[model samples]
Target chain A: MDKQMLRDTSRRISPYIHNTPIFTSHLLDDMTGAKLFFKCENFQKMGAFKMRGAVNAVLQLTKEERERGVVTHSSGNFAQALSLAAKNLDVPAYIVMPNNAPKVKKDAVVGYGGIITACEPNINAREEAAAKIVAKKGATFVHPSNDLNVILGNATVGMELLNAHPNLDMIVAPVGGGGLIAGTALSSHVFGKNCKVIGGEPLVADDAYRSLESGQIETNYSTNTVADGLRTQLGDINFPIIQQYVDHIIRVEEVEIIQAMKLLWERLKIVIEPSSAVAFAAVLKNKDYFKDKRVGIILSGGNVDLETIRFS
Target chain B: MDKQMLRDTSRRISPYIHNTPIFTSHLLDDMTGAKLFFKCENFQKMGAFKMRGAVNAVLQLTKEERERGVVTHSSGNFAQALSLAAKNLDVPAYIVMPNNAPKVKKDAVVGYGGIITACEPNINAREEAAAKIVAKKGATFVHPSNDLNVILGNATVGMELLNAHPNLDMIVAPVGGGGLIAGTALSSHVFGKNCKVIGGEPLVADDAYRSLESGQIETNYSTNTVADGLRTQLGDINFPIIQQYVDHIIRVEEVEIIQAMKLLWERLKIVIEPSSAVAFAAVLKNKDYFKDKRVGIILSGGNVDLETIRFS
Candidate 1:
């Protein structure tokens, strides 16, 4: 996507999403020896950056497509994001969630007006359930992170960060399904003055890191990280953009992820999920390189299950 | 004090404190059926509004008093607040704490340059320890929430809130040692246009509520509340102000406090201490009176032991 397209997508979804605030802490700056600016998407509508992409994707649909409604398979923040986005736009949303998904997640989606269709807790079952909805109900299937429109929408986060602090030396984001970092990299390349983009991945789920090194998409053998959002592999739509613009990937251990998450909660006084802490963990892990530089970290979401948090 | 004094305190502490942002949630507003504005003192420099009073008190100290240093007896956010405030002003801070205070609390004081003197957990022992420090060092004693200068300092919170939202029909603050509510009441009286002030107290530790009815300071026989910060009884210095200016006080159950705290963490995406939640719980408890009116709630602090949090 071009710069104009990113700008247009941001404007299109402006009314539906929040221009999330950037938070800074002197204690954190002293600890890490870097000027850290946290772009808090935790405060975004539906409590995640996914809302930006979801709203833009739905808005880009034609009248007929909008009339047919939308469908997505997710048990994470994207389910709530798409459901709320569709509800706001007066369009129906069908969510395909695994039956094993937490009750809180299912309840949140339903609370946002999403029509749920539960399937087995497997990729094949999820995809099959979503496909059936698209076939029977004439619904538009919207990929959470792989679609071009969704990537363009996520790009607005980086664009807004640069607009607020134009001289940031680097921007770091967690490499989840690769959509957020890819869009961030594209935004930095187009909207910033030499702002480099980096991706933070869980060492256990380092598909994006391996893919970059192998010059092709890679898959994870196991998803055993606390950063649950970063377990998914990269897709073709955003992988090329990430390869072209992303500076490099840094992998952090689960322990480091928890430490960073605790620090953010203690110092910044904001609630953030473990996945969002990966970006900050990467900076702390390699403090020598990031020290003395203005670094921007995207706190992707704050949809943690408070009941099950295990800081130990 | 008056409006000019409140304005002067705001100006004096402006350099040393954060003019913390106000947060709003559509979900919370919808849930309460009122327009709610949260004065986020949880984001204050020391993670509590105590910093505002601490800095102001230290700044107002005479040159001789400052040279001799400052001292206070506390086992909560005030220990860290005074330590950081004194450190910022290049003055020594001596903190007298119960020997049973949490290790994290002691570490925070030390981290902020406060010299700690441990004493028995009883109030008489705390007073004796603090008195010894005063006699030995000839330092100025700064009460955590009972001194005039400190009350003036805390009043800036309400002053700033009024300045931001002039039309607020009422403001709610949790009553602890009574400095915050007394100062908030004064600010609403002086700065607001017919605005009323309310106090939220834990039902188990409802000394402030009882004091208002008895026309004399009252003490809690049992401090069996989860809101640890509000267990202290109202002091003579702030009791008169609270009685004269505060419209009323609302006492909430411990379960209500936890529920409100959860809503803030889940919806507003901010970490607030249980004491802060008392005010929001008060608003929720009396929704009929507050409905359709503009209400402001002061989020008192964010200093919870993450390791020991038991939501159930």
Candidate 2:
């Protein structure tokens, strides 16, 4: 909630997470007419920024709670993040996933030493199963992106970026469940000098965009986005922070997201998921606003299936 | 050829090239049974270590020669490397490529501002065409991997690697016309403390291994390897260097190259061409010799067509 908490969160999570590199490309700069700094959280442990939040949440638990372990309902990067973070901290992790989740995703969670509990493929089922784990095992339950502790942890990325590039005019991130962007917004608000925050989301799953317009949380009826990470809607814990600190959200077309993802792979030569590409796509789509400006993009993750990457 | 020349080359090329990061992976260490330090030249300017050699070669030319400019015959990373290096040094570049070279390759050269001179798609014809340009225009010729100046430049990767981790037991590089490995061997001989150099070549095009065995530069009857950049035979200038200083050459199968390349893309989350994978593949293939040894692998390049990356 305060600058001191953000600083302490970073210090606490520093040993458990990577202070990922900030990369710049002259060719990308020439194309967008802006000096862009990419904070590559894709290179983070377990290949996502989610590791920061997972480690913070697990570390914040009481000794008794830590002994009991942690539980989270996730079928994406957060599952692997929590598992790895818990493994690093010498704590057990119970990951509850939908029954229909991909085997590859489940295998990665298991690979990271997570104990998997499969539930029916529904939000209610997932929460109920996680609650059962909490009740039976006395484990702590951590939300993927809605916990205050997790948001504080995610804010460290922005702190590091602003520390590296203090004069950045703007910081941009993809809006998924709003954890990253909300934390980014908080970091920029307190630590950045004259810096604004923006977020990019897929048009197919623009709940965050509509939420800002309507001044309330919104949901997508159909989660048909290629950016699988952004299909979830914002939660109460992070929505207010986004509303208060975020400047705006831009909605990009699916085609645009694919094009940006390809450019990242082809030009920057870094593997980034579609979710990470949304932020860069937003900058490319709205070049007029960002022309000749210094912008920082948080590449949120790099956990996509490489075999399925499409260039055309 | 000397330490002074290596130091001077570093100073001259530092402004024009990147001192790329060295990355390590615990999973890779476990897989190879060795502690590995990867010098990521794939992140170099123009997306390969070729930039180092190209820039060094261009800078070594006299001012009058710079005015007349540099020429090289190729259709790979060197073509783009030379063009970009020439542009950086304010020198004209004459790129003589076989007419049958891929359009995408030619486009990349032109994109870097190289003057295109189409030649017959044969070694003799390509050389004759480049020779005619050298005679008619008085342009200085730079071989892709056979010149001493370029070898000195490539040696800087080993110098930097050893500078970072001075106690490396071995340095490994993929043998492509023998420049990178030859330079690596020279670096270990001059600067390394008890460090040996090894070369990784495709079993399909294992001319370097054969040359070492035969005590003569051997050519591949069929260049059928996916490691396209490594298909050429070592020239007289670099073959002797390899023979003298290199400890041994490890030849890997095409399947092993693909496996290592996939591991790099999947676990390391970085783009690397099959050629670069040869070095890692060699490490993976020869586990007993490298087990528990501190080894440094120079990721040679990252210029691969994304449309065709495969793991099978």
TM-score of each: 0.98, 0.98
Top candidate (lDDT): 1
Tens-digit lDDT string for candidate 1 (B83-157): 999999899999999999989899999999999999999999999999999999999999999999889899999
lDDT of 2 at B200: 92
CAPRI docking class of candidate 2 = medium
Model 1 regions more than 4 Å off: none
Q: Per-candidate DockQ versus the true complex?
A: 0.73, 0.60
- State the weakest 10-residue window (summed lDDT) of model 1 chain A: A303-312
lDDT of 1 by residue, A1-312 (tens): 577878888889999999999999888999989999999999999999999999999998899989899999999988999999999989999999999999999999999999999999999999999999999989999998999888988999999999999999999999989989988998999888899999999999999999999999999978899998887889999999999999999999999999999989888889999999999999999999999999999999999888888665
TM-score of chain A of 1: 0.99
**Per-residue lDDT value at B18 in model 1:** 86
Worst 10 residues of 2 chain A by lDDT: A303-312
What TM-score does each prediction get for chain A alone? 0.99, 0.99
